[model samples]
Target chain A: MPEPKALPFSARDATCPFDPAAELYELQEREGLPRVPVPSPIMGEFEAVELTRYTDAKDAMSDPRLQMGFVFDPEQPRTMMNQPGNLLNYNGADHRRLRRMLTSAFTVKRIRGLLPKIEEIVDSRLDALEAAGPGADIVHEFSTPIPTLVICELLGVPYEDRESFQRRAKIGLDVNTTREEQIANLAEMDAYMGRLVAEHRRSPGDNLLGSVVRDFGDQLTEDELTGIGNMLLVAGHETTASMLSSGVALLLQNPDQLAVVRDDPEAVGDAVEELLRYCSPAIALPREAAEDMVVNGQWIEKGERVVTSLLVANRRIPGAEGDLDVLDVRRTPAPHVTFGYGPHQCLGQQLARAELRVALPALFKRFPTLALGVPEDEVDYRTTALVFAVNKLPVTW
Target chain B: MTLKVEVDEQRCVSAGHCVTSAPDVFDQRDDDGVVHLLDGAPPERRHEQVREAALLCPAAAILLRERDGSA
Candidate 1:
């Protein structure tokens, strides 16, 4: 295979914002895993191998040799990465130790326990949307707040502090933000989490953070507790919020699929899976090779970075059924690397699934005639961010 | 028919997919969330749910085999 082109991190096809860049797909088809330049705000630009095949992406995610800790440059003051107990900053035993602490909080049974609250939150959001009248930005009025509030309750964040926390989280996740801004946002959130952790230490609530404080207060340090709180607060809301907004936009584009999600109760689970695969909220997850190893027949040297394009890999050939690129809610759920794969597969996926299942159906069912308030092409999709999302999804009944 | 169930502790992230799918057959330790097989040889009636639990294990940690050396 010829030397692959050095593509920028934010390069996506402008014509089809939903799909990965044409160059990425073409390179993957020609050379299963292509070498490309990955630009990181904290680490600057560096060469990294891109995994585009779904099978390879899934398998490589579990490879012990591929470490996530080195994704950031050590010299740079990555406050978020340096935070103790941040799962993404660790691999192997350390990662497992931190992860296990919160695993019980996100177990299927625990998530199922939270279903009633999730439903109530979804219903309340819908009520607000309706009362606001038609022509509301679904991203703001509906998609964003539901997960934000749910996470607030889960992390024991005060309801009054949600808006400020949400603002900081959005800024923290934005790749477009400057290093100074990112650090500032992280510091602010860190302080907020510290206060919350202290409060939990005195009297732990039933929420995730509080439970950890109550159960293992002696084992965990203040920094570790705050880190756990920060990770959940940001990840719990932002990723799901992206899916909610983008999933709605994608459904509107295909009314046939929309009808299936809206009307068929049995199809909701599969619909959420399909949407997760189709939307590919978090574009790529970056990992560093802990040691030299062969991944998908490519020789990746130790310390080299490997970035897997979840968006492209999920949409690769031989998908669920029919064309992988097309949105079909009725299609059987095929394994995709959207929530990622391996031991580190998303901790809160079940909760995210429950949110989508309840929220999407209720949104469409409540307003059967719900349509895009703006032109389809005019819908502003987020391109430069780590997560693929729409800027605003304006809709009307 | 009897179901022989095993959980690879190293691979298990304690997502609880197995526990949720087959509660009677699987349980998790209090110290860590990793699952443990409650009934190694469950009756024939629970075969399907046990298999479903194995299939749903996100980490691919759950393994099931029959006494006759069949999966």
Candidate 2:
């Protein structure tokens, strides 16, 4: 394959420490906002396009020509990037079909029904925390477990197997993990789901896995089920965990904000929005252009992979009228691209909301004295990985 | 009073703040960590607490409004 034309700049020039957002902001300053050719060690070698501006990114998300599962370089081998067709990568009819089928699981009404169960899990985890004492790693002790258990239950996976699967899922998302290790973790998840799918086929349960097997047993292939399971499993747990752990950690650091939340737990919804904008866990979503396109006035060729930095877009950018970054929960009709935009919007958004709705307020009320165990600078943020997250958020109440 | 409550599930990252604020009204199921509203209307004594719950929502999924006619 031939090398693509040189980008106007290097990521290092625009890089923000711990957050690549600085580079995006730099581009925004240059009036070269969208399609800025974000240089990625991964995308650079592959000659893919990069997207930044909100409008272009959303448009590419809904575009039909851009293929999700299509492999540009056959020699690159089928790895995590080449996984079977799913909503995030797929376009047109297949995308519509899969989206429709999974839509019900994400609706607010459907998610609202799961609240009681969500509370039970959180309480149970808090009970364990009491046993462990005041100082605990909220990420592992509380944040990680709650969502892992929840998604496991949703997928019908035995709760007992959650720790191991969670380990595998965590490894799969680790960008620093050796390519082989990453691929191995993904394969391990796929194999595990394969067995579950087979078992469910023989004697299906009432879980999401069994439902998929029953409803689209013929249409949804085993790998497809596994793919969807992987999506649900990883996405379902990881991002939500980041939000909880990070949200608490942030509140602990910002006492005034913490007091605001403590005074009105219902403000959790607004606080979460500000947090999502403030700390967008899913920092960037990679998209590829199927044909020649111009975004934010920059020309982007076909077959280039682009990533929109939602973290940056949510913080600083001119919106319809005012600045988009103001962190005011009272800002009425505030819309965020944190869950993403257009066709690829997060399928598990409602479920994510319900979890926060129950968890955030409960956490504060349970431990009114809850505050960070360490300084804000000391908190371990997930720096190298694709997802902007923290490794461990230690807190004490 | 209208006893208005708004839920922005989108803002909810499933942090479980509401459940702690008002256990009787908010909860986290064993099944999923997502927050749900068990009772549409919270108790009067807990109203202030529920207001706190709404504020703490990491996803900002919960909002409260006081109805003009009743409390």
DockQ per candidate, 2 decimals: 0.50, 0.04
Q: What's candidate 1's DockQ score?
A: 0.50
Q: Give candidate 1's error at residue A174 in angstroms.
A: 1.9
Model 2 regions lying over 4 Å from their true place: A1-20, A33-44, A69-77, A317-330, B1-71
Q: Can you give the lDDT of residue A15 in candidate 1?
A: 83
Would you list the C-alpha lDDT of every candidate in the order shown?
0.81, 0.66
For model 1, how does the per-residue alpha-carbon lDDT over A1-397 read when each residue is reduced to its tens digit? 5432223433578788877788767766776456787755555567888787777787788787887754335466656756676788888788887798888777666777888999999999999999988899999999999999999888898878878988887676666556678778888998999999998898998888888998788899997898888989888888999999998998998999999999899889889988998878775457888788887677888888888878788887453578888888888776677888777888888889889998999999899999999999999987777776788988988
**Candidate 1 docking quality: incorrect, acceptable, medium or high:** medium
Clashes of each: 0, 75
Q: Estimate candidate 1's RMSD in Å.
A: 3.9
Residue A96 in model 1: shift from native, Å?
A: 1.2
